[model samples]
Target: MDQSYKKIEKLKGEKLIEKLFSEGKSVVAYPLRLVYLKTNFDAPVKIKAGVSVSKRNFKKAVDRNRIKRLMREAYRLNKSNYFNNIPDQYAFMILYIGKTKTDFETVTKKMNTLMDAFLKQQSLPKP
Candidate 1:
């Protein structure tokens, strides 16, 4: 599978983002929270994902940007293993909820845990 995160796979559009947060369900693994929605897209990609870091927590744009970059890299490296078999298209927003700065190893470990939780949640039957 391709490991590159291309522009087409980046989630965009204000309306879609609004709908995702308003209607999507979430899976949390400590500092990382993944809010996801199952939806169709014009693009052919199986998943569209975006990453965010809270301005309130980081205070500086430099800090927030670094965290977002780390989160995105972690997601890019891990997503293929967890999501390759999923049949439905999904939109995902990954938010960094921690207050302090973090390292790449920590981010990658948490990302793996988060993806595992997400897959487990997705496999459960609805009530």
Candidate 2:
């Protein structure tokens, strides 16, 4: 409950990462796409997150790293918006899809919208 992004909050391990992409449900808000799966893993926290930027869009490693850092910061700040509402544990991967670099303000707004959308989605009964 520190509200900080600690090592435990970061998603890792090749198998776990692969499972998240293969089985997770996704939500998108412009520059950001979130893929998440509910799990029963025995972890200390309720959520784990990973951020990524496609090399196809930003060829430079520095650009990709910058975008990912921005994304992680946004998520870390707004995560509790949806995190507090969910009872189950989850793993998430956030992907950057914009063709060009976006400002922090834009990414922050979109990240809030994305988490809000996720909260709304969870309230609906699955078909």
Candidate 3:
């Protein structure tokens, strides 16, 4: 099966985005915060994900776009490290929370940190 991620797989819509932010629990790992919800879809891969950067932190559209681009790139390259860390079928959102624009190298490092945190979260004993 082709595993290339297409944009359509991304979680969108006002209501869904709201759920990820409010209803879903969050875990912070420096540049990114993982907001996740277990999904009804049968696939083992993440059904959808959204990446966001705060405009309040980055006043310029170019800087915001640049950071968003780097976040997406990091997700694209390192997504495999996290897909199995989550539940078999789930949708996730990783929000950028840093106050400054960052280079791709920094974004990628943050992605790795987030994924490591995810693994730690995954291994915790359930109540």
Predicted model with the maximum lDDT: 1
lDDT, model 3? 0.73
Candidate 2 lDDT tens digits, 1-127: 4468999889988988889889889999988898988886667788899999999889999999999989988888877555764678888899999999888899999998788777677773211
lDDT (CA) per prediction: 0.90, 0.84, 0.73
Q: What TM-score would candidate 1 get against the native?
A: 0.95
Evaluated with TM-score, which candidate comes out highest? 1
Give the least accurate 10-residue stretch of model 1, judged by summed lDDT: 118-127
- For model 2, state the Cα shift of residue 14 in Å: 1.2
TM-score (all chains, Cα) for each model: 0.95, 0.92, 0.82
Pairs with backbone N, CA or C atoms under 3 Å apart (clashes), candidate 2: none
Runs of candidate 1 with Cα error greater than 4 angstroms are 124-127
Residue lDDT tens for model 3, 30-75: 8788887765643344557778888889889998888888887888
Shift of residue 55 alpha carbon in model 2, Å: 0.6
Q: Give the TM-score of candidate 3.
A: 0.82
Q: Candidate 1: give the clashing pairs.
A: none
| Count of backbone clashes, every candidate in sequence | 0, 0, 0
Q: Is candidate 1 or candidate 2 better by TM-score?
A: 1
